[model samples]
Target chain A: MMTYAVECKNISKHFGKTTALSHINLNMEKDKIYGLLGRNGAGKSTLLNIVTAQTFPDDGEVKIFGESPYENGRALRNICIVKENGMFLKDVSVTGALDIASSFYNNWDKKLAERLLIEFQLDKRKTYRNLSLGMKSQLGIIVGLASRAPITIFDEPYIGLDAAGRQLFYDVLIEDYMENPRTIILSTHLIDEVSNLLEDVIILNKGEVMLEGNSEDIKNKAFYIRGTKDRVEKHISGKKVLSKEEFGNTMAVAIFDSISDNEIRAMELDDLAISSIPLQQLFIFLTGGKMIKRGDINE
Target chain B: MNRIKSHLKMHYLNSKKSFVIFWSIMFAISALGILISIYFKSRGYESVIITNSIVAVVIFGAVSGMVCYNETLPYMLNMGITRKDFIFGFAIYNILLSLIMSVIYTLLSIWEWLMYKLLGFNYEHFGQFFSGVKGIFEMTWICFLVTLCATVLFTLIASIYYKKGMMFLFGIGALIMLLMFIPGVTQAVFGFLESLVLSCAGGKGYIMMTLYSLAFFLLCYLIIYPLARTSQIKR
Candidate 1:
């Protein structure tokens, strides 16, 4: 049992009449990359906001580094949250924004900030309002990474990045984590793209913790089966098939359950292509793949 | 203290243009008033200080109110600075700006008086016009009151609006000030409240006002504590 770096016990939040989160219990390990996977309005941002003290949970308590962070400068100093929209002063240049963050965060690494600035190719003189969407996302990633806090949360921090820019972010993030080793929670819909980087995954749906487990365990736990329609249907019947699709005589079924060696061997002779479902597809099946539930699921 | 200093430095760097514009506009208006006084100095003219004082109060209220919200609020919120520190930091900045404005006005008045004297106009009452213990006290009290009022209002509005409060505060304050010129509105409003309070307290003027101020400050603090505490919702 590792000592949890962050914990949310029995946390429930409501906005007006709508419940944003319900009885949410989470324990995050230190120095692990945890992906908070959820659809839009699935309370990912709200949960991040609550955990970072940007928004308070309507009920229950949160602890970061084993202390209540509300108004606790010592605790907050060790935590940083970079929201997707980028909270920055208008008319403040990129350099000015970084200066402000550097001054505020005692652990702020100026060298890292400068390095990221170069990597992002952001002009220091350019004000925040003038930055393009991708540049803004890069700016947020730089801050979130450079703060060097013990706990850092990035809520969809790569909102508008091109492939190369996003790749740079992912690489720098992993490299930095290996050296610095902080508890990082990345909340985003780009599940498959980031699945390889995640050590753990917490899937949230309809304001509840639908699933949480080690990344490898979750991958091993979920599987997909494809074969002739009758054989696939016969094998998947009453086996918690999350979803099934059929085209002519071929059929595909997604099973959110463990498969034994005998079961795989038995299914093999049925001319089927049994494969592991990607994390994104797993999420799509788990959430019923409604447009609202499968937020931004582009390959 | 270091955090505050950093914030102050950031504010100064951010507010360079606005500070210059505000100070220039204030000086320009006061200079115009002094020039008009100089034009009338040959016979008898001593309204420069009074005119400048009036203008100063108006400018201080408007400028302080707007600056209190615009210059300090967003950046403070963004830095996750507590509203208690916010009130403290903003008070420091507002006081400094007020002192600077007062000093500049005094210097400019003296220069205008010298210019009038150089023009061969008898300006024996220049010292009497600009220098008086009573006037100094009055100006100090008014400036302090304006800053306090604006700060309280801004804090309340900030708590209500959260991060977007500053923008809403500026627009609302401007609208309220514009409405102050309406006939009988100011008196009707303040007088009614004052009378209501006086009646409630049964003529306990000093004690009542003191209790009211303490109570109001306490209530404001209670409200701000939650908003400031909200800064760490997810941390």
Candidate 2:
């Protein structure tokens, strides 16, 4: 069994009367890139904050390396969070900010920082407040990757980056992860962009773990079967129906779990199509997108 | 040591521009004081000169609060350092900066006093400007302590509250204090503090007060450690 880097047990948090997170339990293994996927208000950020000791849970506890991370300096230095905004002193130049980061993170790799600075095309003399949103995100990516913490979490790492910058960030992240693999939790709404990179995917909905498994296993467990409305409905009658759509005489039913020979043969009817369900569609189904706006209900 | 040096270098470099404006204004004030003393000494005059600790307190408090608010507190959550490390690092940096500012101001005052005597004015007639060495040191130390405590208190408040929450907490705190209209509460609290201060150094009230002042500085930091560790970062 892989050693779990972060273990959370029934974690719940509240800000006054507003519940930010509720009954969240998670076990994250080391050396794997896990995607923390959720819609807006899914409590992904709150979970990350609690595990990183930035926020305290009202009930339940979190452990990093089998120890409570609260006020634990030894544990904290091994965790790095690259938030969306990439906070830094407004007056401090890029070089100055990097210098501060280096001093603070004992694991900081100067060479990696230098290379990333050049790759990201961020000016060393530009003050942090003056940098464009894309550049700010890039700076955070550099710090997160270069910190080389045992547990590295990035919350929406590519929010403002253009296509090229996003590509650069993803490419660099993959290359670095391969060279020095660590426990990486990437929280993002851009699921498709990072689909191929994730070894495991955890979908959070309403502050609860809606679905989690190996990426391939998760894909194999659900499939899209399309045919005549009656035929598709008969085929998905017993299996768990994740989602369904109908147009004219044709229908598509997303069935969870393995489809049997009879179900597969049901698609042999004329004008029928059977294909693998895309992860995004599964995410949408699991997150309750049909009934309400996904990521809207704050769990 | 290296980390401390790097932070200092960064702080100095980032603050150099503001320091230039501040020192210029300070120089002008020193020059004006010297000229005033010289003109007065021409006739018979004697009066005590006092440094405005309030101005120094505000400057130091604002600078400390702003710097920590911008850089230190926000990053502490993501960094590997614990709250102890963060508070200690901030305390060291604050103390170093306060020492530099106080020393510079003291030197300027001394320079003004010397200039007054050198401009053909009688030293005794110029008034007792120095207030002796111990007095100057005590005043500087007191100013540093006040600024340090006030800044830490501000940071603690900021750390625990932000935007809407900040206003709410402040409003609530003020409301509670206002509602506590009972007589002698203020006196009781002050008396308790005064007794604690006296006990720290065997009833040498002045010395104990100095030590308690230092303790208050540390106490503010201790109070904020848990706050920084558990506080959430607002978007």
Candidate 3:
């Protein structure tokens, strides 16, 4: 029996007039790198916060290690959340932050921290305020990975890092996880960068779980079908059309259905443009490209 | 028990530097006061004794509140410590820090006594600063209570501000100021407190005030628990 690491049942939250999370139900298993992908205001942080007991949901319950996280210190002991903006104590040295983390988390790996310090090129003696934006983020990442908690969460962990630095983090994260199997919930906007590393992806759209499944399954779930407007419409008549656009007499339509390579090759002679939509492009089509106008619902 | 210990250790790590800074400043102030007393005695002026209990109380009181909001709450939570653990750990921190302060205050009084004995001259000192050799215990007791009272009260105030925002803080300040300006309110408040103090005067006073401080500490914790438990980290 594979035990779940995190389970949210009918969770919802609101801030005055704004709905932060609305009836979100999710279950995550142990030892997999889960990607929590969402556009801004898509309730990614709110869901992660509720899971870690950082914020209370307006409705429903959350369980970690098969126990409610509310006031459940034992359950939370195995969890770690690294926020986008550094939540480190102000004016404290890097070593001081690590010391405090080591004290709280029984499973803290000091050696990992020391190694990551070299990898990230962080100074232990420097105060948190003295670090550059990227350095501050690196410090947060070091703590998150080195804590060695069974359930580690990074809510947009790499906020301000160059390409090379981010690649270093992803490589370190995957290598570390491979050596030590644990549940990791990573939330980030740089979808395609970390997409391949994710085993499962959860997409949140306006405070609800829009799509979720095994990453490979989801990647093969959607494809683009292009041809004349009539041919494309005839081809996708029985399939779910996620979005469609027309350019002169030609049309490109996104279908939320898996198409086999044989069928795709079969349609090649039809003078149609056929290509699979990557996870990042599907994510944008599903959640992004919605610029709000004066009054109408923008999609 | 482990939760409390972890949280306490966590807070201790975060605040240890600040505590040392405050301690050094207090020691410098005490050293300066002692030097002035020695200089006055040499200049044919009356010898003086400047004890540190009052100064320690005032400084500790101011610091106790800022510690909670000074990135402590959010940092602790982000580190996976629960709110229950946080409050328990914070209480431990307050008791531990205040006890250390009280001991230092007592030691400063002892140092002053040694100075008086070495000089072989009676100093004109604020006699209440240290009651006597007996005052050492009393002074420690008083400092502990004052420290507890100040910390818990400030924590409560800070929690309120954290949850309620600047408008609420301004409203509270305005209401307090308004009440102060009203006739007889300030006198009534101070009179009540003074009477409470006098009622617990002598040996009875220290014990009673200590009990009161403990009661007030718990009260403050109870008042702030819900707010702290439900607080979310804001950007």
Candidate 4:
């Protein structure tokens, strides 16, 4: 039996009639990076919270390394979730927070934390409340990287980080992950930026799993076909069309299907354009297109 | 056990700065009181500086307990600490803090007594209010119990507030206000509280107070444990 680092089974959460998550099931394997992609209020944070036992699921269960994480220190010690806000107390200094984390995380890498502190240029003496938004994000990043927990999660860890800072984080993350492989889950809106870093992708759409598969496989299966309206419609007649957009005499339809090379060549010969959908575009087409007001847009 | 100890260490280190500030302000107050007493003595007037230092510690305990949930719970939960360990570690920290504060209060009381002897000024600590409690052990015991009870009670209140938010406090205030307007209810409530205090402080002396405070602490814990265990971490 293949062991999973984190298994969420039929998890559902409701907050005052708003369904945060609905019967969501996910299995994240060990030693792989996963991109938990979703639009706002798509329940990514809620799912992560339930997985980490920060909040209980209304139904179903979450298991970390085959053990229930809720109130189980043995199971919980193997996990670390760095949230976007309010992870550290306002009065706690950067060093104080790191010290607390080091004490709890048995495999904590102090030297890496110190090095990251310098790399991020965060003052050890600065209190959490006094840190800028970007600095606070850097602190969260340092903790997440240095904890070395078997299952490390970052929920919007680049909230206020600049482009250079985010690039640095990606570099450090990739370098460290290569040396010390663990299950890392990155939940963020910057899907394109982290798409390359993700081996597996889980896209949540309005409290449900819209898509889940290997990044390469998903991209390979999803395609955008652009041609005359009748031709595009005919091609996508029996396919799983995720989204459709009309531009005057042309129609573009995004579909998730496997096509043979001969079929693609035939479509290309007929003056039809076929292009592989980027992860971010695929994600938008899967989650964003449905919620948007199509009538408001000009063809 | 190691997790619990780690949580305890986190709580202690987080509160260390506050502890230092508290003691610094306390010593400053004591010094100012001594100066005023000496100046009064030199003018041939008898001025007594009655410092009920235990009150400050009790208040500190209450505030600390009330804020601990908000200040530390999210941070601990984010660090992947089990709720059980957090609560257990917090309970142990509370007990240890009460004991340490009691010891410090006892020492301060003795020091105040010596100052009184040297300066020929009357000094009365909070312990003198309880009749028949004469030794340092009794004083420390009472201090510990009172501080522990205050801490536990406030902790329960804070937990309730955390789970239910400001609405619970409003509901409580509204209930009290409604009860106060009812005929004979206010008197009945005050009468019960008065008797409860008197029975604890009356003929049985320190022993009764200790038992009463212990019972209160246990009751508070019984409520706090369930509330905290199931409590969700709020951002």
Candidate 5:
């Protein structure tokens, strides 16, 4: 039997009458990166909070290394979640915060902390309140990477990082993750930028798990086909059509369903174009399908 | 217990600077007051250094406890400190802080009393509530209990606010007014609670007061743990 780094069963949460998550079951393996993609109010942060034991779910259990984290200090030592908002002591300096984190987490890496300190150009005495938003994000990224916990989570960790700084974060994350394999979950709105880094994907839509599987498999589950209206309609028959558009007699339709290569060949879109969708596009379609076509993106 | 100690260490390290700053200011004022007292005595005038440093210490201790619970809670929980550990650790520090400060004030008061003997300068202390060397232990225990009570009360209030925000106080206020109205109308329970408070305040009820304060302290912890257990960190 394989022990998961993080696992949840029948996880559900509610805020007043608003259901934040419902009957969501997920298992994240060790030494892999997962992209939790969702639109605004899609419950990504709520789910992450539950997994880290920062927030309790209304109905379910979350286990880190096969142990419930609630009041389980030994078990929780394996998890570190850096939120988008502040997590550091507001009055504590950069070094002070690191000292606090190092004391709490058993697997803290001083060398990694020092390297990130230099990488981010962080002054030792600059308190959390003194740092700009980008600096705060950098500090959080540094903590998430340096703690070297078995399960590390970053919820929209790039709140104010510049494009370059964000790239640096991605580089540091991948480099450190490669050196020391651990489960890492990055919940963010930057779908395109993190799509490549994700080994598996869990897409949430309105407090529900809409899609979750291997990243490549999720991307392969959807394909775009273009042809005249009659041909497009016939090809999409008895298939789950994700989105469609018609211009004059020509029509382009995106289908989101399991279709093997042989099955695609059977459809035989003669005098038509067929292509697989990018992960970001597929995510957009899966989440809302509001931006189904390239022309629809601008709106 | 080890976890609680580790959490206590974290809380201390995180707030050491603030602690130092607060105590430094308190002592600076106390020293300045002592200097002026010395000056008066040098001029052959009477000088009495009335040091209520116990009150200052208690206030600071309570406020620090409140700030620690309110501000560092999310970070502490995220850092893996349990609610029970946080309460226990914070309570330990508050009690220790109160005792230490109380002892320091007693010693200073003793010094001031010596000044009265040698230089005709006097000092008044809360220690006067008791007599002889026993006053030191008595006042120390009193200060410890008082500060511990205040600390736990503040923590309880912070946890309530954490659970229900400022609106919770309104409900409490409403209940207070309604209970007060019972004297005009009729409510046996309200009268019982009123008598409980009055009995604790009477001069001859030291044991009862200690018991009452301890009960309140335990009640505070009881209310705080559940509130904290369900508290959500608003990110």
Candidate 6:
């Protein structure tokens, strides 16, 4: 039996007639990094909330380490979710917040937390309300990293972080993850930045799973074929077309399907330019967004 | 069990500074009252100094209980603390705080009595609502019960508001208003409340008041436990 770190079965949630999630099922393996990619209102946060047992799903169940997480301390202790905001009280000092977190998370890494505090240049004496948005995000990052839980999740953890800060986070995340392998879920809009770190990618669109598979496989399979209209259409005829854009007589089609080397060569010979779509562009296409063409904009 | 202890420790650490400030302000007020009494005494006039410190303690309990739900619940839930542990740990924290406040009030009452004897100043305490030395025990019991009940009741209200939002509160308000329009309903409600207060005020009714307060606390806990267990941590 394959043991999953986190599993959701037919999970559905609704808020006042708004379907936040609809029968979403996911199984995250242990010791692998996952990218939970989604647009706004795509139910990424709602799904994360349900997985951590912070909120109840209207239908279906969530299991952490093969046990229900709701009110189960044993099951819950293994998971730590750091949201973009409200992780600590306004009055709580940074040090106080860390101390509380250290107590709750059984596998807390105090040394790492202390080092991160100094590295991030966060003032221990400053209360949460006084910290700038970037510093607050840094505090959350520190907690998420130092928690060392079996299942750690970061939901848009880089909200106010600069490029350098985000890079530093990526470095530390990779280094620590290599040393202490655990299930990590990074839910963010910065798909391009974290795409390299993700082993498995799950894209949600409008309360449903639009795509889920190995990152390398998904990226390799997603390709943009651009050429004359007839050549592009004929080349991608049997493929799963994600989106299409036409500029004058030229047509660009994004398709998600395996391409053999011979077929790629044949498409090139037929005057069809084949290029692998970047994860971010592929995400946009998969989530019902059309690529903007220069001709269309000019017209 | 360890989780509960850690939670209690977190509560203590979180509230330690606020508690110090609260006591400092309380003692400052007490000192000012004493100074006024001494001034009146020096002018050959009698002034009675009444210390309603128990009221301050009760208010503290209520406010802290409500704030606990707002501040700690999300933080704990984010940290992966189970709702069961949060509620259990919170209940323990409430009981312990109530006991400590009750003891502190009892000692303050004794100290006030000593001041009355030594300085020839007329000092009355909330504890005096009950009789002499027996009043000490009754006062402690009543104070503990009141503080605990207030804490639990306020926590229940806050939890409901956190879970159900303003609509639930408005519904409750509307229900009360509708009941008030019915004949004898308002009178009956006020009459019941008056009797409940009178029961606590009269020394002989201490046992009854204690029972009523315990029942209230239990009811609040029963409602709050399930509400909290199922409550979502709002982002």
Choose the strongest candidate by TM-score.
Answer: 4
Model 2: which residue pairs collide? A77-B80
Best by DockQ: 4
The docking category that best describes candidate 4 is: medium
Model 6 Cα shift for residue A298 (angstroms): 34
Quality of candidate 4 docking, DockQ: 0.75
- Every model's TM-score: 0.77, 0.81, 0.89, 0.92, 0.85, 0.91
DockQ scores of all models, one per candidate: 0.32, 0.47, 0.66, 0.75, 0.57, 0.73
Q: What is the TM-score of chain B alone in each candidate?
A: 0.53, 0.69, 0.86, 0.92, 0.79, 0.90
Instruction: Give the alpha-carbon lDDT of every model.
Output: 0.71, 0.73, 0.80, 0.85, 0.79, 0.85
Q: Which has the better DockQ: candidate 3, or candidate 4?
A: 4
In Å, residue A81's CA in model 2 sits off its true spot by: 0.5
lDDT of each residue in B1-235, candidate 6, tens digit only: 8888878878887787778788778767766766777787889987676775677898898999998887888878887888888888888988998888888777766766676668787666753434442656777887888889889988988898888897998899899899899999999999999988776664467778778988887888899898898888885
Output the better candidate (2/5) by lDDT.
5
Candidate 4 per-residue C-alpha lDDT over A101-146 given as tens digits, one digit per residue, 9 for 90 to 100: 8988988999999999989889999988899999999999999999
> Looking at model 5 chain A, which ten-residue stretch has the lowest summed lDDT?
A290-299
Better of 2 and 5 by TM-score: 5
Output the worst ten-in-a-row residue range by lDDT, candidate 2 chain B.
B124-133
Cα deviation of B13 in candidate 4 (Å)? 2.0
TM-score of chain A of 1: 0.92
The sequence of per-residue lDDT tens digits that candidate 5 reaches over residues A1-299 is: 88888888999999899999988888999999999998999899999988878888999999888899888877887888888985888788888888878877778899999998898888888989999999999999888999899889999998989998999999989999999999999998998899889999988878877777888876777789888898778767877777889999999988877776676785674666788888888777767745333222211
Candidate 6 at residue A115, lDDT?
89
Residue B5 accuracy (lDDT) in model 4 = 78
